[model samples]
Every structure is written in structure tokens, then in C-alpha cells.
Target: MVMATTASTAAPTSLSSVTLEVADIEAARRFYTAFGVDTHIHLRASGTQSTGFRGFTLALTVAGPATVDSFVGAAVDAGATVLKPAAKSLWGYSGVVRAPDGTIWKIATSAKKDTGPATREIGEVVLLLGVEDVKATKQVYTDRGLTVAKSFGGKYTEFAAGQSSPVKLALYKRRALAKDLGVPVDGTGSHRIVLGGTADAFTDQDGFVWEAAASPAPTPS
Candidate 1:
């Protein structure tokens, strides 16, 4: 994985792994396997107390509308609840689904129409954190050695791409993200997600935790 150069050994500049905390590990494994994202992330069994929204969502970006439909269909068939049906929007065609473990997922594409047949291929996976303060969160990440890739005032911030990580990182407003996901904000307790990287372990401003990874994460084939 590419990272910022230092006088000593270079430190990783991007997240290396993302692990979701779920109530039932086996069930979540089954769900993600069917949803076609099990290979992209890790899962853990946790009984931590958490209610309402977990303050985050993992998004899958595909090639076109038909691919989006295929993913959404697989998630539904695997027992995911549709928060928003796949349809054309101002930005693209997308849909939202809630996993049985209470994690939210958004599947989207920039193309309004399909140019080819649907396939179980995913182009990108983003972990969007819903924070109380986007600017503060962005600063926290920047200070930790992550470079900014995109910024929109105080509304959003995306970090530089991780060359070897399966997932990318970004920040968004809590209420705005909830609104976009068609859910109410105001979740409390555990965020139910953990980020893994080469950096030391710590919790961010919005309560998201990070842990030091033993080794670099493998890129999806």
C-alpha cells in the first residue's frame, strides 16, 4: 500500500481494512456472501449495545444500472431489507438495503442506463461515516496522515484512494446521510464498525474506532 514518506519507515496513508460488528457472525457471513461483498470486508460477532442508525453506511459502486439491480437483487434475496428501491436519481441509479445485522448499505452507479448485461462485479466500495462535524472529522483524518481527495465545504470529505485497500474512506453529515438513506438520524451507543490500518489504534471524534493491522490488506482480484 502507498503511504506518506517519512524520515524513518513510511506510515500507511489510507485505511487497510474495514470490519463490521454484527450480532450474529455466521448469519452476517452468509448475508455478505450472498450480497457479493464478503470478500471485500471482514466481520466480527459483537454483543455491544447499539441502537438506531450506526452512523455509517458501506456503498458499492458498480458499472451501470443493470449491475446495480443485480447487486440489490442479491442483497434482497439474502434477507436484506430495501430502504430504497433501485431507480434513477439526479446523480445516478441507486438503492439502499439494511442487513439483518442492522448495517446499512447503498448500491449505486453513475450510469442512468445499462450498456451491457448485469454481472456480480463491483467497481468500488466506500465506507461513508456520518459525523456530527464533517470539517472536524476531515481535519482529524488529515492530521493522521491521510490526504484529501475531495472536499465540499463542511458537507463532505473523501480521503485519497487506497491503492491496496479494498475499501475507501469518506465523511458526511449525519442527518444528511440519514436523509439520503431514507432513515432517521439520532443513533446512540456503539458505531458497530472498526477500521484497520497500519497506524496505532484510537477512536475518532465521532466515536469510530481504528486498530493497527498486523499486515497490509489484500486487493480484491
Candidate 2:
């Protein structure tokens, strides 16, 4: 059975916020604030570190490196590996590490900026697929007329379906994805699919439900 914790109906039309796990809330707070991310909300408690933005929320709960290591274990067991490990980068981003689930996230402070962008540009959208074999999945998509945009070893691969806008579909090892989503591995694939407008989620292979949409909801629609 697939369970969705939030009421979000679709994969966000545009990239909203990416969450990260941090070891020190105060340090993480200072980093992002310095980076110029508008910190609209901040909470420090025994079990939670949550922040809100205009369109999204980022949560950083207190956990030890072992917890993160355990998460890595879960991901590996599910057939994925750490793309990057938890470390403090000179660039000012700090977090435990990154996983091969098609998204790169970090826990760190925001960089200092003189001006904020009036609007954000849309970037490539990513999808994580759980397939029987990485080679076979890549072949199938390629055979279906999709082109390989990039490949991260045999564990992660991206496909370009040649959409006019910047969008791409990705395939990843399922176990790693389930770990990233903090869910149990049922050996099925994603449940949500994203289109061009009004995002909606649907159940797909292996009862994995995902969210998709054409674009972000209009302001007054």
C-alpha cells in the first residue's frame, strides 16, 4: 500500500524547496539565512527543526551521524548509494550527504546576496524510477525514443523525452528512492506522474503513487 503523508495533489509544478537533514539547527539556520533564503519560519524542539517559505517548507530534525548512516544503509539495501556524503562544503552548504534518488539536497546556510530574483526560472524536472535492471530500463526508455541526457554510473540515469521546456525523466534504484522518501520498500515504482499543468498524482507501477502537473497553479485560479 502507498501512503501519502500530506494532501499535496501533485508533484509541485515548479521546483519548490528541497529538504535536508542537519546535525546542528542553529548552524544550519545561520547558513541558509546568510545565503539569502527568506526564512519565514523557524522552530527548535527536541524532535523537529522546521522552516517555512512562501511556497514550501523545509524540515531538519536533530539526528546523529549514525542516523544518517542508517539512512544510507537503508538506501543501499534498496539498491542505491550515496552520491555525496554529509560534509561541510567551502561553498557554505552543510548537510549529512546526498543520495542517488535523482535529487541533490544539502543542509547548510544560505549565501549572502544583494538582491533576490523577482522570479525563479523553471529547471529540469526529475523522476525516479524503480526498475528490474538499470541497463534494461535505460534501454527501454531509449528504445521508446527517449534520449539519455546524462548517466550517473549504472545506478542513476536521466532521459530526455524532448519536451520543448526544460524537463526530464529519471530512473533510479527503487530502494534508494524509498529511503529518500522515508518509506518502506515495496519493490514497486513511483505513483505520481507530472504533466504540464495543474498537478495531480496518480498511482503507477507497484502501487507507487506520484504527483505531476503541467505547471504551478495560477494565483487566482
Candidate 3:
């Protein structure tokens, strides 16, 4: 396992924070807080919000469109790959992007027609992948069979295969990704297979760790 020694000199700008909706907000909060991120608990008269200093905001909400578009665009501008351009669907306007750690982000606009605060909602599900080479990883997904939905330099790339369910995947450079996500890179490599999903982690010759996940049907809007 390689310890991340390089710190990102670039301070975050534009993206105020990203919120991840979880089945258990408290569990998510505990996991991330233990990962070295500064956390804040905001309790409103109406509800509560947990914000993480790792440049993301976490909460639970029904998903919506305008929120999806705004969130996806901001992530893309901030070096994330915009997989599927935001568009209207039977469900809503959907978009996909890759986070710094090779996690797939599925963003969808709401299907309901309303102008209220709850009209549009945003959420993200992460997919993990394993790869031998970051450069080759990008190529395998972009070269021939797959389609390049979007690319952010060599750091990240997104591909779409026209699946009925949301399919946005990202390739991450192992060492760099570990530093960004504040996780210790395990040299031995690991593979996790869930009933309907699969994830594996391995290092390339350059010792870059990688993870890939196959998610269930996109979360209900």
C-alpha cells in the first residue's frame, strides 16, 4: 500500500460543496469523517444537514432535474467528466460524471412537473473499477467498442453505452486518486462482488490503485 504524500496545491473553487444522498446518512457521515475530512452538522428548524470538508455536502432527498444539471455542470467544470449531457427522459433530464476516485456519479432531473423546492432533486451512486494502467484504462473505454461521452484531460474519462439504466463510468489514476480520496492504497489488491454489483481494486506497474463498480438500476426519482 502506498501512502499519499502529494497534497493538492489547487484550492477548491466554484464548487461550494457536493451532497451525496445515502440510505443511511449517519453511517455515511461516520465513514467519511473517519477518512480525515472535517465535518459539520447543520440542524435547521425543519431538518438537518451534514457537510464534509472533503469538498462535498451529504444529505437525503428526492432527486430532481435542475439540481442535477447544476450539480453535473459544476462537477464537470471542476475537472469531473460529464458523461451523459443533461437531457429530458421518461424519468427526467439525466447526467453522469466521474468523481476523483473513479466513482461513477448518476445525476437525474425530476420527472415530476412542479416549481416547488422539492421539484428537482440530485443524488449520486458510486461505481468502483480496477485497472492496470490509467492511460490504457481510458483507452479501453474510449477506443472502439465504447463511446467517449466526455473526457477531462487524462485525469478522468466518462463513457456511455446506451443502457436503459444510467451507465456512467470513470477511470482514475491510482496513486493520484488515492491522494484525492485520502485512502491508503493497498498493494495486495482487493475484489468485492455483491449480488447485483461487482467491485475490484488492483495496482498497475506504476502502482496506481483502481476500482470499478456495477450498480443496480438507477435510483428512483
Candidate 4:
């Protein structure tokens, strides 16, 4: 994976990994693996709380309609429910699917598909989140020291992309999110996603969970 340099001159925290809580770890793993994402599973302890989604979507960008159809087909074969079938849109040929774990995925390709596979083929893995307020949510991350790549429409926004992990971050209005998913806008409950690569465990203003993946190096030990 090509690393995305931080837009910040110095970031207080950098993400190491992403975690999603699924009803069946192995099942979720198989789905993502077939979809070309390798996820490590952690069986929640007996006393640990379970997880649910406020709203989330993992997006993938491919070279042409062929790659888009191929990968989306693979995801469908793996038991994912197709929310939006592959087709041309204002953006390009795009489709949406929801995994058994309730994570929504959108696979899309550009209209002008001359870009090499090296520049294409699932280069973008964006995490589109549902939040109470778009501008407020954007501020939460920016205040934490991240940079905004692009944002508009008051209902949607995204962090600057080209990061170490292709999983770019984005936000949307909660009501808009529910409308997009054809579900109710409910932000109460476990986020189902875990942010890794930090020294402390903290929840975002929106209540998403994050855990430390590694400790910093010892000085002159």
C-alpha cells in the first residue's frame, strides 16, 4: 500500500489500523478477504459490550467497470446484500453493498477509465461516517490536528486523502446517512469500528472507539 503522508506538519496521533465488530468474526473476515481486505478478528471478552453502527460505509475505487463488476460480484457471492447494483452515475459506474456485519460498501470506477491498474484497482478505501452535524464533526477531527482534503454541501465532508492506509475518513449528516441507507438515523450504541495506532483509548466526540495498537519507542533504554 502506498503510504499517505500526513497533511499536518506534526500529528498528535496517526492511525495504525481499523477494527470492526461483527456478530461473526470468521464470517466478516471471509467477506472482506474475498473483497480483498484482510481483517484481524478479536473475540470480545465474555464481559465486553457488543457493537452496533451509527452509520458507516467503506468505499472502494477501481479502474473500470469490469473491475468494479468483478469485485462487487465477489462481494455479493460472499453473502453481502446489494443495496445498489453496479451502474453508471454522476460519478461513474458505482454500486453499494452491505455486509452481514452491517458495514456498507460502495465500489465505483471513473467514467474515463484509461488510468493504469496501478493507479486504479481499489486505491481508495474511504470510511464514510454518519454524524449529528457535518461541520461540527469535521471540526472535531481538525481540532485533533488532522487536515481537511475537501468538503462542501454542508451535509458531506472528507479528510485529506493519500494516507499510509488507503482508508480515508469522511462524514455526512446523520439524517442524510439514514436516508442513504434506508434506515433510521440512530447514533446511540457501539460504533462497531475501532481506530488503532495510539497510546491511549478514547472515544471521538461522536462516540467512535479507538484503541492503542503500539507504544512509542523508549528513549535511551
Backbone collisions counted per model: 0, 29, 16, 4
What 10-residue stretch in candidate 3 is worst by lDDT?
Answer: 37-46
Q: How accurate locally, in lDDT, is each candidate? A: 0.86, 0.37, 0.38, 0.64
RMSD of each: 4.6, 13.5, 14.8, 7.4
Which residue pairs collide in model 4, if any?
Answer: 4-162, 4-163, 4-164, 149-160
**What ranges in model 1 sit over 4 Å off?**
1-12, 219-221
| lDDT (10s digit) by residue, model 4, range 45-103 | 12234344446767787788878878788889998888878888777788888876777
lDDT of 1 by residue, 1-221 (tens): 11222222344489888888888898898998888898788888889998898899999999999999899999999999999999999999999999998999999999998899999988999999998889988877787778899999999999987778888999999999999999989787898898887777777777888888775565321
TM-score for each of the candidates: 0.92, 0.36, 0.34, 0.76
How many clashes (backbone atoms < 3 Å, residues ≥3 apart in a chain or on different chains) does model 2 have? 29
Judged by lDDT against the true structure, how good is candidate 1?
A: 0.86
Better of 1 and 2 by lDDT: 1
Kindly report which residue stretches of model 4 are placed more than 4 angstroms away from their true locations once superposed. 1-14, 39-53, 112-120, 161-163, 182-188, 197-199, 215-221
Candidate 3 structure lDDT: 0.38
* Candidate 4, residue 221: lDDT: 8
State in Å the error of residue 86, model 1. Answer: 0.8
